[model samples]
Target chain A: MTQTNQPEINVQEKRPLDTGTAESTSSEPRFSPQVDIWENDRGLTVVADMPGVNADGLSIDLNDNVLTIHGRIEAQNPGKKVLTQEFEVGDYYRQFKLSEDIDKEAIAATIKDGVLAVSLPKMAPAQPRKITVVQA
Target chain B: MAFLPFFGRNFSGSFWELEKMRSHMDHVYNALADGFNQIRRNYTGVFPLVNISEDEDNLFLTAELPGLTADRLEISIKGETLTLKGAKTQDNAGDETLNYHRRERQAGSFSRSLTLPVKVKSEDVGAVFKNGILTVTLPKATEARAHQITVQAQ
Candidate 1:
């Protein structure tokens, strides 16, 4: 395999900070994201739209092909003490069952601007190859 | 609005500030934006506009529009302010069981404003709302668009 940089995860900062908008109801799970998956030549790209998550509070883990994402958002405290506030805070949880064809070791992830991207490279069998046969 | 993940820093305050009642008025401003409660670390998309990016000629603005129809979704520019307003609501629409479980998606009236970084032909703005996405195309003004005028020897 040719040498290239393994995908690294970095939390890109938000801009203008005004797009900093998010709301959660009392009973519903707060700050959950909806994920969209797209397959490409090299691997599968998962795009998850999760607004209000920040760099310091995110956790992504893979165990036995089960991918889990967890985060925590501090609840808003009412009645004074706050000046101007911007940024969404919430505890988050999401999990996915990854395909066996994926090369989990080569998986790369990045989270920025409340979007999470995961690239899952496929294994040898997952790629197409020409077959060789001899007549018996 | 108090962004949920951003309310932690605002958690500290004194009784005098609250007792004096100045803070009560400030809550209205936050309430208008829809306060963000319970903030945690999040995994969001990160696309950077760096010097090396080649596609600066085309501006991509993807607005999250869940239910608003094409008729309701409006994009207009007055002076320098670009305003987008729409509402996505269903009548008596959600299942009670689902709402009881976990409802994260925000479905209601939404109005967003964006100030363009560059001047564009306001009259030429084209907008399309499809599949819960609002894509607007604003042709760059003559001076704002890119060009290469080479100088020749006289």
Candidate 2:
């Protein structure tokens, strides 16, 4: 198992301080999609469960050390009357703060079955180097 | 719209509060995720979250089910209620020896029954699942369809 000096992935339903142009159709509350973060020798991987989110409706941004994931959920039918609603449906918002160890430019992401997976590669200089034993 | 997580600690004590909320939400989500197996801990309310809407002739019910396939799900309509039952199995790539840093996504069986507002023809009902969202369209019965009344002005 590869060792990671990073802390646990903290996910929350909060918007970044610098809000971008992400418009929602409804006034319903936006929930934070549950996510799982794991690290290996190569880099870190983040998997998020975002049901009802389409590829066109998902957006990811990395500004400075802050990384944000946004997803917009469409209504079942446009201009239809809702009879019953168990859980509110709205946009999905979450963010993470990246350290200097991560290579922001090398980040890649893909969404399948409404699950978003992001790969954040670590910088070469930040990776651990094996030290060889020498006779002193 | 609230406190930022895993970012610069802009406000003191707010991170902890948000963490609490996140855990609480996770608990609820996990409970729903585990409700299908009947062996879930912290299982409380409903399982699959749903949204029911009605148009002129059909009623649409949409369910949020991530990573679920047709074989794992079962849908039935009994009288005025529509029941949704299914299970989600974790795909571990046959490697249980691998260590997991954080395991939040869950797998379990869940059954949820919802009562329809109006009568629907079971034979004419249509369902489609796309992108992890299951949408069931139930056409209204002949008597349940809307009747328009026209007024004649003098």
Which structure among the candidates has the greatest DockQ? 2
Lowest lDDT block of 10, candidate 1 chain B: B45-54
TM-score of 2: 0.66
RMSD of 2: 13.5
- For model 2, how does the per-residue alpha-carbon lDDT over A83-103 read when each residue is reduced to its tens digit? 987566667888988878898
| Per-residue lDDT of candidate 2, residues B14-67 (tens digit) | 767888999999999988877754533224336676778999999999887777
lDDT of 1 by residue, A1-136 (tens): 1112323222233221111355333453444455556554556666555544555667788998898776544343333222212333345567778888888888888765455667788775645778899798
The digit string of per-residue lDDT tens for model 1 on B70-126 reads 786666797556776655443235433221222233345544455666677788877
Looking at model 2 chain B, which ten-residue stretch has the lowest summed lDDT? B36-45
Model 2 complex DockQ against the native: 0.21
Interface RMSD of 2: 9.8
DockQ of each: 0.03, 0.21
Cα displacement (angstroms), candidate 2, residue A46, comes to 0.8
